[model samples]
Target: MAPGQKLYPRATVRKVVKAHSGCNVSKNVDVMIFLDYMLFMQDLMKEATIEAKQGGERGVTARSINKVTKKTLSKFKG
Candidate 1:
């Protein structure tokens, strides 16, 4: 979370998530997507900390890390 940012609605997030549940993106895309997601979260966390240090409000954003985990599992499943 950040200043003036609202959390994504659970239902909306769920809908977005469900649509991507079976995405057939390639391995390279998968890796890049996951890596980009992780990096984005990491940066957010850092920003949150900095904001908190500055006495501004800080918050956490929910992200899907398991998608990549499932992708990895799928690779081994077959």
Candidate 2:
């Protein structure tokens, strides 16, 4: 947890991992890795959204990434 960062409840974290893993409960290491990846992706999405709103060419890249992320997240859906 970082300064100014929101702390998610342990149950919420476990639920997210289970949903992504398609299992009752994911391994601790796997959960940590997934959470890290999700954080990176969220940051990317935020940056892209901002750029797109500003009419930047990078908006195209953002859209592409969003599509890919959506597909990947679908596979992990609980």
Candidate 3:
């Protein structure tokens, strides 16, 4: 595992459950699912942050504009 990559221990798992307002029967299981989802969201946030910074340096146009234009052009090809 890397710096922030580690499996949830039993205690952290419980906390995640509580954070999500879990019920008794499937709380732990739900927590595990939530942990995985949170981890995925964290990775996406990190990537977006980096991309935004790089885009900021580029200037003149935003990524959404570029992305939409690319999609529009690709659609015309079909």
Total backbone collisions for each predicted model: 1, 0, 0
How would you encode candidate 1's per-residue C-alpha lDDT over 8-68 as one tens digit per residue? Answer: 4655544554577765444345445557677666655555455455553343322333323
| Collision pairs in model 1 | 1-59
Candidate 3 regions with alpha-carbon error over 4 angstroms: 1-27, 57-78
lDDT of 1 at 18: 53
Report the Cα lDDT for residue 64, model 3.
36
User: 13 in model 1: Cα distance from truth in Å?
Assistant: 17
Residue 11 C-alpha lDDT in model 2: 77
Tell me the TM-score of each prediction against the true structure. 0.38, 0.38, 0.38
- Among these predicted structures, which one has the highest lDDT? 2
Per-residue C-alpha lDDT of model 2 across residues 1-78, encoded as one tens digit per residue:
678997656777677767776878644755666686787677657655665666655454746556456655654454
**Would you give me the overall lDDT of model 3?**
0.56
lDDT of 3 by residue, 1-78 (tens): 789887758666666666776655454675656776676555544555566666674432356344444444443342
For model 3, name the residue pairs that clash: none
